[model samples]
Target: MSDSPSLRERVRTEPRPHAVALLVALGVGIGLATVHWVGLVAAGALASLAAPTVRRGVAYALGAGVVALAVFAASLGPAAAAVPGMRPVAYVAVGAGLGLPLLGSLARAAVP
Candidate 1:
């Protein structure tokens, strides 16, 4: 048999969940700042695409969401102070940020 690694083998040895999650979180934060909800969902889905399985994608999404939430909370004060009615927006953003990852995971699962 040939020694070349298959796609499955390559994917299996790719970055771990924590690393993927952290990267996803960073991208999600940037996306949230620039493009709002659409960016957040896209970032989460793209980031988790590297996962070897749906279960791992879900876990990575959760970790990414948590990190995104922390970033959102830390930045909330400045945003809220600058804009009126920012609290409600922040709440929605945070919730969406958390939930979008599940959608991303699902999307990942739906693919091959």
Candidate 2:
């Protein structure tokens, strides 16, 4: 027989700390993202990184991507309609900006 508590018992005992951490991360992410009203993408990416769950992470990523796309399309509609070649730049910018939050969340998760 094992000496440690069962998985359910462990989860019951350790629920609050991780929940608090996740909430803190989520708050920070949402705050930063809402600052310029353009960081939703970053927030979403950070949300994914804050939680270890793959389903949650992917949902966050997709949500962020949709927000980014909408923001880009709205912000650059005129230019895009005129140039027809700046779409790639928008993609790159969104990717880079969103990547920052992901990296930040990952770093936070790495700490003890």
Candidate 3:
């Protein structure tokens, strides 16, 4: 018999880490909240490293961005109401946060 492992065996060996993805996303949210713009990029890069695949990394980034936006809105409250334009900015920030990490993961996946 051949020594090569079957596709089913490979799949069984490689289990996805959903919990870790969520935890990393939560950390990204916190980083986005406390740090400057660089924080978002950092979080994305970190998430890419933590996730097993590009798709998972993208999901993590999106989830983290949403959570961060919610925290930002909740904390700013009336201030956000005063500056409605900032709402759009926040959405853009979330998009950027997700996009950069996805790009990073994509690059990594492509190279390796």
Candidate 4:
């Protein structure tokens, strides 16, 4: 039989989670800054690609989501004061901010 490593072995041999997480966060941050909500999903897929394990991939994506939301809120500054007036749109915004990354992270499971 061939001597190629299994998926788990490759995953286990990948870089440490901290490094992977940091890289994922940076990508997520850039994505958020340039592409808006679409960036979260991109970050999720990116996290999945960078992480050494599926669990860590999801966690990184979630962390990126939190960071994305925090940065978005912070960037809003005084404009954020009007958020309460946004009503249902705020719910969609919050949901998308958190949900898209998780959705994107699913790529890890789908991929080899």
Prediction RMSDs, each to the true structure: 4.1, 7.3, 5.7, 3.8
Task: Name the runs in model 3 displaced over 4 angstroms.
Answer: 1-25, 85-112
Residue 5 in candidate 2, Cα distance off native in Å = 19
Q: Give model 4 RMSD, 1 decimal.
A: 3.8
Which scores higher on lDDT, 2 or 3?
3
Compute the lDDT of residue 60 as modeled in candidate 3: 56
Q: State how far residue 67 of model 1 sits from its true place (Å).
A: 1.6
Q: Between prediction 2 and prediction 4, which has the larger TM-score? A: 4
Q: Weakest 10 consecutive residues, lDDT, candidate 3?
A: 7-16
TM-score for every candidate vs. truth? 0.63, 0.41, 0.56, 0.71
Against the true structure, whose lDDT is highest? 4
TM-score winner among the candidates?
A: 4
3 against 4, candidate with superior TM-score: 4
Worst ten in a row by lDDT for model 1: 9-18
Q: Give the TM-score of candidate 4.
A: 0.71
Local distance difference test, per candidate? 0.64, 0.53, 0.57, 0.73
Taking the tens digit of each residue's C-alpha lDDT, what string does model 4 give over 1-111? 779876545544655654655675556554664666677788777766566678977987787777777878988999999999998988987898788988888877777
What TM-score does candidate 1 get on C-alpha atoms?
Answer: 0.63
User: Model 1: runs farther than 4 Å from truth?
Assistant: 1-3, 6-11, 15-25, 78-91
Q: Total clashing residue pairs per candidate? A: 0, 0, 0, 0
